[model samples]
Target: MYWWSAVGDYYWSYYRDACERSLLYLDVLRRRGEDYREQSAKAAPHVLSFDFVVLVDGRMLPRPVNYGLLRIIPPPEVETDPGKRPFIVFDPRAGHGPGIGGMKHDSEIGVALGAGHPCYFVGFLPQPVAGQTIEDVCRAEAYFVRFVADRHREADGKPALIGNCQAGWQILMMAAMEPELAGPILVAGTPLSYWAGVRGIYPMRYLGGLLGGGWLTWLMGDIGNGIFDGAWLISNFESNNPANTLWKKPYNVYANVDTEAKRFLDFEKWWGNPILLDAGEMRFIVDELFIGNRLAAAKIATHDGERIDLRKVKSPIIVFCSFGDDITPPQQALDWILDLYEDVDAIVANGQTIIYSLHQNIGHLGIFVSARVATKEHAEFVFNIDLVDVMPSGLYEIILTRADGAEANPQLISGDYIAKLEPRTLDDIRALGGNDAADERRFETAARVSEINRELYRAFLQPWVKALVDPAMAEFLRQLHPNRVMFRVFSDSNPLMAPVAKAAETIRGDRHPVEAVNPFLALEKMASTSIVVNLEIFAKAREAVTEAIFLDVYGSPLLQAVVGVGSSQPRAARASRGDIDLEAAHAQALADMTRGGFIEAGMRALLYVLASGGADERQFNALEALRNAVPEAARPPLSKIREIIRRQAELLRADETKAVAAIAEILPEDSGRRAEILSAIYRVVSGDGEPDAGEMEKFREISRLFLGKASPAELHDRQEA
Candidate 1:
């Protein structure tokens, strides 16, 4: 009976492993329940690694806001350089609590700290300050920036602002209002143009239209007694990916019970800690931003009667969006540029430098959370902050090339790589991708309908709902929400889960894990896959129905007329001011070309040539090194240097030949200085690799103007090099 004994051993191993896994899974749940209980007892809990003390509390403001600024104290291992530019990171307050930007070592704050920069975080309390408006929050953020700048007065520049998702728009608003307070601003996975998305491809944009718009939000807020439960927003996020929410997430933890528990629990801690918003604040965000699309159009006004115009922001803006991010697609992030400017010329004319980088396939959360992205994209952004700040006013596409010649894999980058900021045009953006006007019209109609519905609800339904509900009932509803119920049911407080801990302890002592080749384990995987597939099918069907209903209802000619959809085309472009005297500006640039000495002229020519071919991190680092090589007495202030570069770039753009020739006219006729300048230019251009034809030609032109034609020996040396 040897064959019978083998079969019996196989069955016993499989059965024992399965039972142990079940117990361990229950233990995971028990721990999760305990963690939830502990978290619930705290006010404004987060997962930040570093210690911090509050610098500015928004609650103490004249018009109180929930936001606060915390100065992160870098650990002993992480050195801080006070002379380096400081960084201020603002996490998204969409639905969850803060600290996503600094939750782990391979995160935004971590990268900044690694680079020896002082890091600060903008966090908020669990509850909003009563009657706090969006404008008040913006003011508080401005105050925070001013305080940070004051604290870092000895630093090279103002603090670089990093805004994640919802904080992106908030940061923009603050920058627009007080441009002097910001340095280079980086917005990750932020949607500035809410109505922008490719039809049929991204269906989340249609949800507001499908739900009859902002009235439902208003009703929910009223039911909550002037506080909107953030659980609803989190639920909406979960609904977008049902298979992940309902099957894959749970199955992943269950299938890898031993390893996945901590990860699942860590993420759930943030996911479960939903924050609240004032009713007015929620209404404004829904109506003005998502519905009216006012932010991009510069229609959003502050209490002091100043229109919040993004163009007013003097700092360079860096937008990081992903193609796979359904929540804030590339169109939503980049379309605001098209909305704000008529063309690339307008963007330059406004003296604004905008840089955008697109990740190929990172999801919404991955843009900010993925360790791979943190170490690569976010690190590059931080390292290149000064480069972006000094860049000439223009549109640029931040290109990250692979260091090892494979592909531009972010995970492969580990601080040693090449990053390029290539000049781009509005046409490049249009070619990249965006939604059409027809899609926008439907959203506009939804906005109008929402206004009508909001008025009707306030006039009728809201009063009755408010009179019926009290704070206790509202609290009960929040506690009974499906999102909360799931955590509560799996908690250790439940009598059914009492035996789980003891059973898990016993299983842990006698643990047995089945091999991957096991027949039962294979079956389990197949079952899990089938469950995910079925749930995905249902999700797709539901999305189809939702989109169909939205289109049919909002697309109706009768309803369109009622909402005044066709009254006039949406004001996509601002009226031409006809105020900028282009000829006068050109003349002024020409006159200013001869205003500097050899150092300035040489630097200008170098920048012009680099601009012609585009610049990457290598070129930037070489230039910085050259600048540092200059004698202290002769060195110009960095601000003055940037000003010179800006004026030189403008002149080159206006007339390249005149601008290049003017550099020779401006510099002294000293062959030694000229040779030194040419050598520096060669070094900068050839840092990454061989210079391209355009770069070579630009260099040759500069040389002809400054150092005459190269001799045969020089030409051969250049070719050989």
Candidate 2:
């Protein structure tokens, strides 16, 4: 009986091993069947470009849009004339493919085409075209813009360029290099100042430092036999959301596998086909951008030693980034404006127009890919690029909010698009990048440590590793990568479970789907949520420990002293185009200032109140009422208010010499009246903190030209005589 039991156990073990081998064999057959099916589908006439490319390039050669190796989808059957303003949509070459702009008809390109603008796409090949540097891509994109511009110049509006994500910075580089070739430039979710961010947030900027420097990129490129897989970058992005990466994303697809097949396939096709960057290119990005933070510092130099000054671009810049984007946070996107100029006035003074829009909560991918964002934000931006072009040269926040029915100045477009305006201040923008010196010092120290580690790694490990790697092995490894394997081996045909595939297809076709909003579905979602929560907890704990260790070692005051913080100030004032003459601006500014007499009078009134006693609400209300009821003639023009302030400053300048006599002259017959007048004048004159250079210059000139060499009392005495 004991011998019989032992034989049975052996038989069970053999049966299990045979079953696993059989399953593997069946998977290979099913994958071949799917490949055959895909090839058959490609040959079918119904599928456009065999479910590959949708747009046809109508150039002289009449090439396929897929010649660029990007899948381009054309708009619906709408007759858009080629004579209209052409729209060129450039997808940011981040870790993803090009279709984020036109994944659907409600995209940036689609919205432009819907508005009668002829649309074109600027995309890249899946593999780099041999020696294709970023400079070559910029040139190609510029040539594309030139083509569109020439096509639509007769229509009066220059072709508009919409750049998404990493494409935003690329477009700016193109625009800066060839300012005359393009029109409006819209940069969405691109970081110009790579190192700009506040503490407790935007910690992604610290990643290169914590992991060492660009040498890791070099190591990866070496392992890949001179090609750095973009999947690594995509993995870094996924690591930011561990719950989604580990469980939530896969579970959701599995739960709705029947309905999610097409969507999952389409997205996976793009996300899975990760591109490669050259070792040198990746090094430039990590060294010049990620660690050096040189772009905003005016320190990014070309191979020829020429500097790429962002201020040189003549076209208006529209910066669109969001708070929720960890990759390209609002700080990295907008702080470059602050870092490149002294103030909002300096931006205008440089003859450069920059407008930025900040969304409350949209992640990096959502900035250009999310359908809801495309409908609302991208729609408004397209409708108003012309308005934005005409806006006064200064920094502005582009706000998009719902308009009430009765609002008079609503700008309406096709189907539920309503947009309006609200002014924003520099203070509002400072919330993102306004970190103290100590925080910046910490990051600086991290950069130093990273440099040291990177050098050490290259000296010790790289030589031995490179000797063991080759191109064929790299390619094989890439194919075997988990992301690639999913596409290569999956779906319908297995001898062991051939029935399951047939069942799934039938279930998809004959779908008795429950309502998406069902209560039981919500319970299923709750169970999934628990799994996600636990994953998130583990990820957070890991991140916290990593950050703590990093900070403990590299965040010391001694390290900060050794590796200094980069200045967030502009190196020097950018040379202006002299479009706005300084004298003319001064006159205009004076004119605007003089028009606010009541504001001047209120300041005077404030001086009296503060000097006498702090005013109660009732007293303030009474003063406001009286101020509102004043006659129009009494209210000064901007010129008069400035003139009054000018004369008062002049009086103060003469205070050392003619203080008593001048005081006697402007003083009223009553001592109380004289005190009141002097106090009011002092408040207005000293509003911007004593006298500045321009104020002093203006005062000297005004005194010589207007009042001659006489005091107020002398002039009064002369009039009396």
Clashes in predicted model 1 = 0
CA lDDT for candidate 1: 0.84
Instruction: Give per-residue CA lDDT, model 1, range 370-403, as digits (tens).
Output: 9999999999888878788888898999998657
Q: lDDT of each structure?
A: 0.84, 0.58
lDDT of 2 by residue, 156-268 (tens): 35777888877888788878778767667899999887767765556677677777667787788778877777777777888888898788766755565544555655555
Least lDDT summed over 10 consecutive residues: which range in candidate 2? Answer: 43-52
Candidate 1 RMSD to the correct structure: 3.1
Off by over 4 Å in 1: 1-12, 405-414, 567-571, 575-583, 611-613, 632-634, 669-671, 708-721
What TM-score does model 1 achieve against the real structure?
A: 0.94
My TM-score estimates for the predictions, one after another, are: 0.94, 0.68
Candidate 1 lDDT for residue 589: 86
lDDT of 2 at 594: 29
